[model samples]
Target chain A: MPERPGQAMQKSANKRRATVADVARQAGVSVATVSRVLNAKAGDRNPVAEETCQRVRQAMQTLGYRPSQVGRTLRTQVAHVVALLIPDATNAFYAAIAHATETALRERGYAMILCNTSEDPAIQDEYLREMQAHNVAAIVLLGAVETAELRTAANSDTPIVFLNRRAPQGVPGPFIGIDNAAAGEAVGEHFAERGWARIGCIRGPQTSPASRERFEGFQSALAAAGKPLDPDLVEQGALTIESGDAAMARLLAGGHRPDAVFCGNDLMAYGAHRRLADQGLSVADVALFGFDDNPLNAWLATWLSTVHVPHSQFGRAAAEVIVELANHRGERMERQILLPFHLEVRASA
Target chain B: MPERPGQAMQKSANKRRATVADVARQAGVSVATVSRVLNAKAGDRNPVAEETCQRVRQAMQTLGYRPSQVGRTLRTQVAHVVALLIPDATNAFYAAIAHATETALRERGYAMILCNTSEDPAIQDEYLREMQAHNVAAIVLLGAVETAELRTAANSDTPIVFLNRRAPQGVPGPFIGIDNAAAGEAVGEHFAERGWARIGCIRGPQTSPASRERFEGFQSALAAAGKPLDPDLVEQGALTIESGDAAMARLLAGGHRPDAVFCGNDLMAYGAHRRLADQGLSVADVALFGFDDNPLNAWLATWLSTVHVPHSQFGRAAAEVIVELANHRGERMERQILLPFHLEVRASA
Candidate 1:
């Protein structure tokens, strides 16, 4: 029986395991040449002959030697690791973004460390500290953060990128996300174009830039259409299903029922749909508009009209910018990249 | 401004930051005393005054000293990290599991590294090698690795635990999951009791042990109830929403169109529901059963009947075992722990 085949083979092959010196000796090359071959750091510096490279490869195969990634990372001063911090990993929108970002990062030979903050700033700070301690190559933040604090903590050396949210002035990082103001304007125009006059808005938490931007855009669009802003028609809640349900209930009880409703996100829209259903009112009775065209929003039972933000594109763009920043940390940084959004007209609105 | 108040302050205040020597100096004791204080090392070879312990704590606080987790882990042979290899992060079921596992591990002071394999064996090997190289404290594998070649490479001093799947015999790891066979039997009995004589099963892929056990249990239950196993009613696919939709379409196309369907997971069940709705079939008319009572299953529209596996408990138990092994690497290991599952009867069934 091959007891511990993997372990025994590795142990018995060579007691000390092949080092750069051993490979150099076996391949009849200098230690520097062996290091260059193993680390892929030669890069037009003292290029080796094709025959010598082949001999080095053969020597490595014979010795069963695997180069140390940690050592290489330290020597290069690049960890090849990026940290992604999201408010919640269970949310489909964020999960999809994380999936896309992970694929992009992997293609670029980088590993991602996923941290779930559950919308708690303390947890976010802890994760940020941990990432800094690990010397993460770059960071992609998906949720809102206090601008001054985040900017101070991030400093200039660490490349930071924002996704689904915008950073404050002078943050020195690229922001990749949908044009929230445009999305909100589209929703407002859709409601107006459909001749639904009375509109109520359920906004996300006040701290989020996405929420604030959308609210401003919606208000501006309504004003342009000669409609006065009704404070009684607005309700504020967290961007969660339960919060949405609660906000909708409050709107219903306040006696300012509108014929149309615009929600901050799809999860909230689903909650509003359920609440309306519970009240014996169908979604068709009140036109509903949601943002972030998540997968669940397209279900047959709930064909939600939503602003389709290109989630995958957002992720890919963020990854590309961060990778560039990682390559050149001290260069002048790009400010922001606003991706376009489309309106998915479904039966709901 | 407090520059990097968390860890950086401590590192900068003292030239070398909180080393074993610094701790000893503050405690008015030997270097070994501080090492014992941090590691909780066994054997009390030195005695220190209670006042001295207090002074040590005060000094650490004043200097903003945080112990080097890396150094302690190195000396104690405990990395304080666990690697979780998941099939996919986009799947809500898997995401929920990963979320719960991460929370559990974090509460126990263990960091989790989530690696998405995308159901590829080669990628799984790459992640396994990365984990081994990091000297992760333990590993929790969520997918099946059939080939002995890959298994042979997993020989490490770190403990490993299998989740949602069973490893081959003599594999050096504990298996933590529900009794899939029993859950399937329960599903079969539920279908039979509900008077759905004609039933179809959207079985998972054959490579997974959970799928095999579930199929066996379902077949055994049907046989005991005098219902012959109908080969035509079975459609094989992966445990994904798209696969479930394809499998359902196949079943409908076949001559045997059962009134009820049992899906391998909740995502698949949701897909089945979507397909049925597209075909103008009401959920109430055709009963559907799913496994893993995911949070989304409890939504009003998708009140899916499912087998409730304590996912959080699974994570907690796995972390506990890993922490135990990390603390005592040489101790005799426990082989397996089977968790209990319950049937959650909802509107679908």
Candidate 2:
């Protein structure tokens, strides 16, 4: 993913100030090497030869280049900035991850620029472009926009670590998350053990791999238990309370209401619970299960039984992965770290 | 306040590339004028004189200066970045505000950097320093650290707008929020109407102005109604569920279980509610009033009757105030904009 020398120089020359890219191009070295030479810690051995370091330093002087001083650490030449992109900040699940990640990053001497794309592809692309311009050390993505632009950006050399998601097909990056399919299977197993014949599920958008996997796993597990999911009971929501409410209502109106229902997330569960309550059906009458056990769900007067995915661990892992990637001085290795998830039994289901 | 010419030049010359400050000093003009000339929009009347614009352009050329392309808009010298500093992101009240503000800013072609200080003064100081380094256009603060650094920074030229908070005495800035005292009085009146004699209150930390105001108003209203708050019934918490739970426990152990209780915020109410439930004391047995009618309260089976401060409005107002200040090229103005608050009567009280 290293930039072509001609392309790097051409882009830099077009600007009045010579960027880090310009120094790399002029010194006939990679951007990483130039960064290391300029920002090397006192005890760290120089990866580049002394003469080569001098050459890079001289090129920087000749081009009037200055390292990004705003968030740049003089010792490591790494920007003190990290960008955290989430789909929705208002969602407690993502908010918890963000809060944990920000705390972890700050502890590591990095300032995070938290961006909420609100699940929009265009905004995601725009924020990625902005991050590129700022020369951030790394980016941690809690959600992704699966578009050509995202695919292109992911293919680039910018160090990225995704939380709760894998890089889309054709893109390359490390990821840390729970096994969505396995978690879904756990829900199915639980329902089958309770001998619930008519089961319903509300899924997220199909574009999300996590959502797709969850739906697939749940269906497969039910099929194995001789009770395949009824198409009429299956509904899709956009992961909002309103969507969940509407989806639940649709499921009920389809002639057979599920004795027990599984929601894609805790927010949807809350919505589904509300819809049931509105229809004079109590949670005790219809068992409810949810994924992503946000703290709010447990604290509610009526707690939800859900798949407890450790969001704090997901966030801390993301920070650690990015830090490792940023410090790596050679070819990048692809990693996929899976965290554990368990079903939390509560009163609702 | 414009930087002194000598100070600007000295600061810029220490780096390799000449900054915007360097160009302004060389052109004998204010940084705002230099910014305006370089990033002028189509059909917008040039703010600087033609001759002065020429001098600025020449200075840029001579010094090889480049504007920050990462998050900067060509139409305004302002960086496209705005930092929203919140005390806690996990708290639904703050999360709602953060979400609304981010949406508003994004619509105005600005990206938001959300920072969670976790209500720690040290972290607040660290974040403020980091924001200063990143050169954000404006900062909307949902919380503030009462420190000398914060006081000094407020007096600087960086446009700041306080949301749901007032600038500490010496730190002057514009603010947008509901009248906390009035909202507290409303909660008190509601309790008074119910004719609850033994009213216990759980207040947030004394350092929080919002918390202090709420306690004062609630106590005064009770006195006005010929019923005064018992000194033994009062407890202090950190506006958290644990704090609320412990405070409620203390009230019960004091051999005077109140017929009703008031919490400074919804989070504390949730805690107190949980504790009462644990003791087999249903909310129906004891009326509870909470400030900040967070959506969670309504979603819970036992709803909370509390003051509803329009969080979305508060967020939008913060964005508008900053946008106005950014667009104003002349002197800065300090204005206190008060929004309305109302009682959202629900089931718990």
Candidate 3:
């Protein structure tokens, strides 16, 4: 049988964890002295005696004493945790964003609790309530839907940053994201420049702000080229590869066979690519473009032309805003930050 | 300009959050009564009066009061949070495991704090220390290397579950993983049955137990069939797509041109496929096999024959073990749970 640390210390069946008090007792010093030695706050004029500090360190090492962050958080009334609410985990776009955000947050001494809501309103609300109830230091919502419960939670003391998504009007938080309309317009320009007459589009849900913006901008760009939108060529996807594939299949099977198609995101593009290939139709014949240049685009053999939304930049920018907001809680500051994006034209288009 | 919540709350320029005391005051009840009503513990014969309960609920709603979990945890000495440490987030294999683990943990009423170690030992150590300090409910380490600090942490009171990785001997924790050797042997049998000679292998670092086991089992199986292993045909990869590509390039550029190759994981296999395609060597000519049948296998056009480890099952089993150990902290329980695996034969083989 493995001997637990608690039991190892007890020398009996009864087990308990070592506390600061135990370390203090072992070091023959006050709990405050031990804490002072351990914390070693900067700018403190009076430092602990070297011998006393050494004794405390030795005592801690001997007792396997690890200071409890829970106790510290209780005293400070601020958790060193940040809750990241994302729509999906499998999507490479969100995953890359998460990776970047986690890296940035770790550098700033904050642990990230990732919540995959999967576009479920109930799950999003539940996670929001939990983050608020836990008093997490900050909350970052990436491509999340706005709800009354979320708006109410936004009124709490916990700092909030909207990453790749904007909260409802009147909500206070920094939203760091690319201008989707501009990116969409760039894609539209690419298609028009390529002289593709019959165009099709696969957009995300109507409720999604980013999707709506992209669709509107694409329409505006096409109208500028004297090509009004064709309702028959438009389809709504659930922002998934399967949905993209189905949408592409519908377009291919429909009367209006478009020579070009722009997907809402890269995953959808992959789906479109697969579906097109399955039907013996090639991406070269139907120029395919996607949004969010996820890492898969660079790795996969199918080079998808995409509007690159610098996910790492968004992560770094959101971290900066959230950390700034956390440091200046209750102080008015800029609550919106828009980043730049580029159109990466690859062989697929 | 967004009207900040702090300013909105402060009609008279002084703002504060509504607390339990405020709720109790509004409900005309004791704090303890409100606590009991809110908690609603099981088998509590003395339930709060229906009218009082309604009043308390209404008070809570009107005040927008959210109970702080920090206070509850301080009192209860346990957090409703678990930490999942992964070596890489972008790797589809680890991502699938993370997604599954997070879903299982969510079902069990535990929030998951994902730590992306990125295969950095320093980062891993820092996260381990942070998880221990935070006193998270439990810690789930996915494919972590054994270290003295980790061993010490394993001996702590927190329930730990090693998922897809085995701890060194005498480590106090439950390890949940598939029998890699058996899985590898299955792959070897497939190769031998196909009468494939000149078999090359790309294994992960020697430090990885899974890699070593797979390589060993493959060698053993090949030797059992009266076919001795060729040391020159084996190359150690970094378990990445790029590494696999480089390893494949080396094999093809070298004198020994193996007709068949087994990669450590799917990412590496993807890399090898890309390199082979670039070199005008089709997968059809050089049979390629991989491990970890992640979601990408189904999405990608190339069907890769690989060993399926049932990642979701591994996650569920790990959660079960961790939850059980947490509930029975000091009790002697099963410390190891070995899962079964099978070889998934796809077109690439």
Candidate 4:
């Protein structure tokens, strides 16, 4: 009988510690039988005769034996684990996605192991290798897979689903995310409708599919509207607050300042908002539009107009895809899941 | 040589693909040598000499031969992994911590496995067990250990360092975090000096040490000011925007609203800000204070007054401690480190 912490403390206080022998005696079973039952391994050993198993179980319950998970994991090959690789966990957008994904994973009896790649292709490969070594059942990649190395590694045996990212053509896997290109087009139309002609865009990293697709859609929309897309007005940044701040600062320093600014993500928009405010310009004064309708944007203080990615659904769908793949054992069709994105108009832009 | 995707596209436009042997033949290497190098096992075999190693490396680099991580993990016992378990990754505060921690861990040649526990003790325990099963070197637990089960499980052989959460007395390990009690006292003193008559506080989850310490410190400072602390004024919430909103709503509904509100964390403050705003109340109208000076709070839109928990330092220190423990396998040190916290007063409070 393994004494639980609560019972141990109580017994120590009362000087009535119960031993494994005592439990065995009470159950009319051998110490080994009692031990096996407490460890949840009775199912593996000769079915334990139902009456005896019942007695052993009752003994463990009365003795308050808390089975050690450490011991159990060592015996079981299935760790009930999965791995999630993302650009950064601290970004609220990614974090929200991770949080939702974790919740869904846990409900499905899977534990998630997370990796922060920081958009570095090398680091991403390293984490991928590590996750593989852990025998993670599946992987959910939340950022762009830049190098061919990552794609090839993922293609072999791992049931990978992309979250907030898209696999290139010929990559056999499911990608669960919003249509970045369409979202960008919507942003451009929103700006054009608002009569903001001279728009400056702070794009995300060029390597990311999201950044490229969004840029393509925005450019297409601007071209359709007969607006010349100024290459000078466009600047690339990593999807980060600091990067956004730096890009916005550089844009401000440049001689030509556009009336409206479209940021790749909401965090970047917030950064642009800060820079504008520091320059004695408020959000209302210099219209700012951002991608990812983060919950913070809805707050009165930051009322950031943005595009809303179905973050929770993206996560749920990704998990479902992975679970489906796991159950079918690689027999399911390769899915390209593109959830919808909403344009949320607020006070900022 | 493995044909480049571009060249392949140009050649066939639509073909299934060449095999690994074909790539080896093109690269001018034996099939076995190519297999060893592509599998990331060049160092293990003597069959491929140094010159051959370089040639294969260059060929794979040019040919873009990415080995499957799943196959490698199945063969090797070394996962080269560690887990960074956080309460909420989307919360900028936790996200920043996780990013820094991952960076530190990666630099040490360990892959970071991220787990968003959502402050759920059960989920936290499940993740911890999973990490152990995967043979992770160590675990860095961020935020609060919300369950007694997790607290006990943390005390096992698996090395764990609690980030931003204080362990119970005599836990026999170091807990790296800022002094929440002192931070709360600082907020109390700030409110006292500002001459706020009635002070309200939004505490975090009851299970968290941060909430208890902050509550204690706030109570002490208010007691020193001879201001009768109203039990009804304190509201409990999960460290989230929604929880903060709901708690504030409860506070207002209870009709025990104070002149100023001190939040356990920034997200909650942001949430409370939203509720107050929706109710047509300005932050300036009712003073607000928050903890964890997250990057978002520093934004011009937020400008929230907060207690700055050295975000990077928290992650760095925790990583340093775990790395130290891992290096000295036989040595044991029960250390308790308390980092400093600073108060940042902005336009909001």
Candidate 5:
């Protein structure tokens, strides 16, 4: 898509096009070194030695190796582009992470390309293949819908890092996220102190391992507090406002009148709050709790209580690990990197 | 960085490597046809005739061709990656547009790559160069900080589309955005209907043309209503809550007791609202207005009256224009496209 001169295709006497590896061999340097020189600028922090850069240029001229016509990306290790695959970017939680990750990647001398998968397995698989074909240096998965495809796609050629989401069992790449069970336990304890008798759960999709873990921790905490989460009170669906509203309706339609509700995420909590408000009920009548302290909570959802995941910390850690893996090829870092989470007490719960 | 078999690099007797173009020549078809065959799956909607695809495969097999050994991105017109450059994704306004654009692009057989510039000229310039190097099929710009650089970067090779922001003068690209001045007039008219006196303005940075245009429209409408916007009541800074709050403080500290204030964006209005609340005042005491009815506005900022720029419409329009440009290379389409805007009168103004 970038411009190349007409002379690049005009061959003299139809000679074979020289490759970047050929130039590397002639310059007596590694392919990576040549690639770094080609991609980096004069005052770049990478700082390829001027003398060696001159040698590479001289070697290129002698071999008539025009970088434009040589298919440079095919033979080079410096793609310099990282792909971040998330389920949805419209969510404030994911947007915060994406913003932080983009900032961190820019600081790490790499560009991030964000792809939204909308929690569709086919879409995620297609994006995985597309990233491979595009020669991205690395990938960061926030929440993937297809684990087996991701497992098969993980290789030394293109490293993958899971952020704020657990990777599949035995996935080779590093997984960087907060401990969901601990965070959920914290939320449950905070809600438990209120002494609510009937605590209902509006969880995310059943396929999400994080949701199940959080549900388990909440149940255990509630049981320890002598107010267990009722099995008939839990509803699972998409982690969206519409789903939360539907689930809240279902919970209220039944004979059991829950005094408090725990939502999978803050958006769902917002939905549940609005749903209650529509029925001439305030949050004080039925407390609401949630996870993922969205960035807009202070301005918008001031009354809802939720858990705050340090979004920037998780993004920075994920980017740092991916960069490390990219710089040191064929290397594995920590298998699981955990960050801290916070529970914020607000008016709703 | 995708995995390639070891045998791809272990050359057999040092023979010359074949190229995709070479295979196309051998198969008696265009290079694009061969690339389509190579990248498409068995059930793709881009129905390449099975007979032609078979001939291309036969040609490749006869020539000992391995796609992993070739730079498939180069020498082909099917990059299929449309890059959307926005100021920030954390802003719910931009995130809404991004979500809509991604859905449209996926439906059109393209993947959208989102890059956040944070309104930094240097970062935007660097991302422009990076996108070119990565061979993105097209680029869509929203609130670009550096216009001259973007004008120079636009070309037929990778078509550019200006989205929700006007293009630089003489730039060769389709500018698809709402009429900012008209939207400002609508806001001003709505505010005028309230019969407020001594209206103040918390404007965005002076460098933004849209902000200037909006101010002009607002001033004109205020004048038409016989209540002029005082120059002493205006303060300009970053379009963020901090700036808006500081601007409001400056307005009050300067002895300008304004009954209403206009913020350049919704988040700024939220700031102004909070600033008033801190002083034991309310929106009814000093009405506040804003633009960009963010997705979370209904849930979070229920009282802030604002202009609603249809984010999904803008996103869908931009994506459609870019896909058309990418499919029809070297063809100049419409120079400017305008979408509609609406003024949402909420409790704040």
Candidate 6:
């Protein structure tokens, strides 16, 4: 909307920083004219009036108007935007990662367009195309849902960074994930030390690479310790609290009850713990472990031992990689970024 | 990056959607030429080879290429992007709102740029100016922090929607908020139904208008019931679990023993519940209430009674209003939107 007579007075009354529009108003020029001067370049062919340019610059100085990188982004066509695709933001794990990524990108004067894909490959594909069409700087896929659309996006002109999940089968891209196998092995070893003879596990969705890797590495460690994981003790379900509760209920109804159980994520662990509590059992009787040590572990659900995936580190690294790739500054180094994880042994385990 | 040799072969191997660049390649024309043809106006004066336009159109048909709105955004200088300013996305309240807002905007072919300011006015200012310079379709401030920058942005050209908080000071803008004061009164009356004589309250940050409104409404209800709120029983703290815990601890240590307590949000109630549990007391003994009924109520923290604030409604309304205002359809009507709330009576109360 065009500014009215008293709008400038209202703006000044509110302490709004001067914008190009403000500069344009003072210089008696158009907003586009002001932008042209702000984004003036060497060897530029377009001829702008010298007097007009000086007036715009003088107006900027008088108003303390610091031009934003937006003009440059328009000149380049590609927006300073990174579309972050996460399965669900309601999950604290994704929320933390999104927060970190937003912080990192904002520091570089970039904006993050967050998408909640709901673990559906179709949703993921839709967002992927829209982001590409908008000429976003990059796309960060968190726990990417493997689809044919993703396979093509992997090799598109825009760069993609995968978190927790590796590149969709065979395509090469900048991938960021943790040493989940090692973390799982460590958890297995810690469980063995706790003297729990009958250990069970509640795995997340089988589609998730992280969940599969965690379970596989766990079995490897158990086998090495002369105690192969009992096949009857494992139950697979979605990564939700309800699924975890049902899985735990099934585990209890089975013939051989496990003394300790590990879940795919914290939500699953909470469900498992709640089920046990309802059954007049406690973490003291059946130890539990979960993944993704949410920041609120200490305040709520402190008993469930969990693995701390450095969400901030994941976000920062993803943002750094995206920015570099978007600017064409990264083409060789650090294609596969592997972060570390640690087990938080709480009272539950 | 330009498509390398055989990159098309790889792209074909995958199911990637064809972009404008692909159209340019198939037609053997410059990318700019393809864009010009895609964006041809009713009276385009630039003379171009009719054969070239036909070839470009044929390439688009062969590739099943659907031109995106990006070209229109470029021509108009206003991308279909909305800036959502949130205090923190990690909180389930804000996270839910963000998710809903994202969904609504996505349906409208717009993207949301989430900004987590952590209640800092300075950071909010930086993001405001940046969004303005980028010419975002609108700015949605969730629990807006009162700042001069905010006051100015309230009157800026770009549409601004205030949620949870009204416009800074006296500035006029569209707002989406629940009837918090009425919700508080409902909670107060409900507490009286539970036959709790000694009732206490824990408030959120003093800067938040919602918190103040909620408290004032609660006091009004209590006074009507001939049990005016006791100042000694009230504790003001931040909207954090730790703050909630500290406030509960202080209430417990006070001279009066309250049988029921109301908190600003569910997190605070969780903290209070945990504190009571730590002291070997259950909600059955000391009733508790909270606000913003998180979706995880039944699965986790089932005992903490709360008020159900319609976060999805807030997001949807904000999105609808912003879209209307940004597109210049909303000059008046429904400017101050007030959503509804309900009392969720859990075992805690």
Question: Top model by DockQ, which number?
Answer: 3
B39 in model 1: Cα distance from truth in Å? 3.4
- The TM-score values for the models, in the order shown, are 0.85, 0.75, 0.87, 0.68, 0.77, 0.84
| Recovered fraction of real interface contacts per model | 0.12, 0.24, 0.34, 0.22, 0.22, 0.30
The candidates' interface RMSDs, in order, read 10.8, 21.6, 7.3, 12.9, 13.0, 9.7
Q: Write the per-residue lDDT of candidate 6 for residues A195-278, one digit (tens) a residue.
A: 799999999877777888888888898888888889899998787778889999999999777999988888888788878988
Question: Which 10-residue window of candidate 1 chain A scores lowest in summed lDDT?
Answer: A1-10
Interface DockQ per candidate: 0.20, 0.12, 0.35, 0.16, 0.17, 0.28
Which pairs of residues clash in candidate 3, taking residues 3 or more apart in a chain or in different chains?
A: none
* C-alpha root-mean-square deviation, candidate 5: 8.2
Backbone clash pairs for candidate 6 read: none
Against the true structure, what is model 4's DockQ? 0.16
Q: How would you encode candidate 3's per-residue C-alpha lDDT over A28-137 as one tens digit per residue? A: 99999988997897777889999999999999999878787788787777778889998877777788899888999889988999999987889999999888777788
Q: Please give the C-alpha DockQ score of model 5.
A: 0.17
Least accurate 10 contiguous residues by lDDT in model 6 chain B: B1-10
Q: Looking only at chain A, give the TM-score of model 3 against the true structure.
A: 0.85
TM-score of chain B of each: 0.89, 0.79, 0.85, 0.74, 0.79, 0.82
Query: Model 2: clashing residue pairs?
Result: A39-A77
lDDT by residue for model 4 (B1-349), tens: 1111321111112222233566687679777777766655535645567787788777766655545333333344334567878877776777788778877776775667778776777777778766665556677777656466565545555566777786655554467777778788888888888888777889997777778899789889888977756888889888888999998898888875678899988889878888998889878777889888887665433578898888887766766777777765434445556777788898877
Which has the greatest lDDT?
3
Rank list by TM-score:
3, 1, 6, 5, 2, 4
lDDT of 2 by residue, A84-192 (tens): 8899887788988988888888788677777888878888887786675555777788778778877655655556677787788866677789889988988888888
TM-scores of the candidates, chain A only:
0.89, 0.79, 0.85, 0.76, 0.79, 0.82
lDDT assessment of candidate 6: 0.81
| Candidates' C-alpha lDDT | 0.74, 0.78, 0.81, 0.72, 0.76, 0.81
Stretches of candidate 3 exceeding 4 Å from the true structure: A1-66, A253-256, A331-334, B1-67, B253-256, B331-334
Tell me model 4's lDDT, rounded to 2 decimals.
0.72
Report, to 2 decimal places, the DockQ of model 6. Answer: 0.28
For model 3, residues B15-124, the per-residue Cα lDDT tens digits are 46677899999999989988978888678889888889999999999987878778877777778789999987777778888888888888887889999997777888
lDDT of 5 by residue, B227-249 (tens): 87889998885788888888888
How large is the interface RMSD of candidate 4? Answer: 12.9
